[model samples]
Target: MAFSQIKVLPTTPLEKLGRVGTNDVYIQKEGSQYTFFYKNIENKEDESIRNFSFKNVENDFENFYKIIIDGFNANPIYDIKLELPNDYVWLHYTKTTSKLGVQFMTTNKVTQSTGISQIMSVEDVKKLFEKI
Candidate 1:
């Protein structure tokens, strides 16, 4: 018998954490590295997953998240990327003489798509983070 190579799609086994809107959050471990994963389901037939790496899951991640949450104190800028790994998210703030709104830009490298959330109030952003 001769040996033949088989092509397989790369997959990282994940543990489900929770879901955020159309995105499902998960955690994966690769040796000593811990990765955060998100799967965005556009429909029953289409979905994509993205990965973000974190050094210290316990302290570093918590501190970083706190810093992000605290940033709501100031007015939002036009484009500010969050400290999250792999450029996963961007904060978009719009302020006009007549209106002020907050929005987020999230990217999925695997799918090569960037999604913009609907304009929301500052409080809505805070509540969304708390769910994660």
Candidate 2:
């Protein structure tokens, strides 16, 4: 994508969060590099959970989500994206009796959903991630 094609979407309001009435995530584009932000569900010093870093997001999705879940045992919806077209997006992983499922969503319409990942060996995601 061209650098000029990237733009930041307006912020959305989320009441499920605390303290701040609403925090905004931005989307920006600069050529092929795209970036976005997901609210840090964990406060600093909350070692129980970890923040998304260059390592996890840059790694496999399954491993990333598992590391995230294992961090706090809390399945959090991540605000993530690359650098380039700035926009807000979320990756949500749900734990079930039989398996764990991954989903992609946006704050604008919580009711809408898309299944981007399914229960599978974390290594499988690691493979596809490499091709990306």
Cα error, candidate 1, residue 113 (Å): 1.4
What TM-score, to 2 decimals, does candidate 1 have?
0.43
Listed in order, each prediction's TM-score against the native is 0.43, 0.28
The prediction achieving the highest lDDT against the true structure is 1
Which ten-residue region of model 1 has the weakest summed lDDT? 17-26
Query: How far out, in Å, is residue 46 in model 2?
Result: 41
Instruction: Please name the candidate that would achieve the greatest TM-score relative to the true structure.
Output: 1
Q: Candidate 2: deviation at residue 6, Å?
A: 27
Global CA lDDT of candidate 2, please?
0.34
Superposed Cα deviation of residue 100, candidate 2 (Å): 1.2
Model 1 segments more than 4 A misplaced: 1-71, 75-78, 83-87, 96-99
Per-residue CA lDDT of candidate 2, range 9-96, in tens? Answer: 8854422211111222222333323332334333333312111222223544345435534433343534343221222234555557
Name the 10 consecutive residues with the lowest summed lDDT in model 2: 15-24
Error of 1 at 77 (Å): 3.2
Where does model 2 exceed 4 Å of error? 1-85, 107-121
Please write out the lDDT profile of model 1 over residues 1-132, one tens digit for every residue.
654786677975654443344445434455435555555443334555645566665677556446545555565344557655554676566766755555555775566565554454555444444542
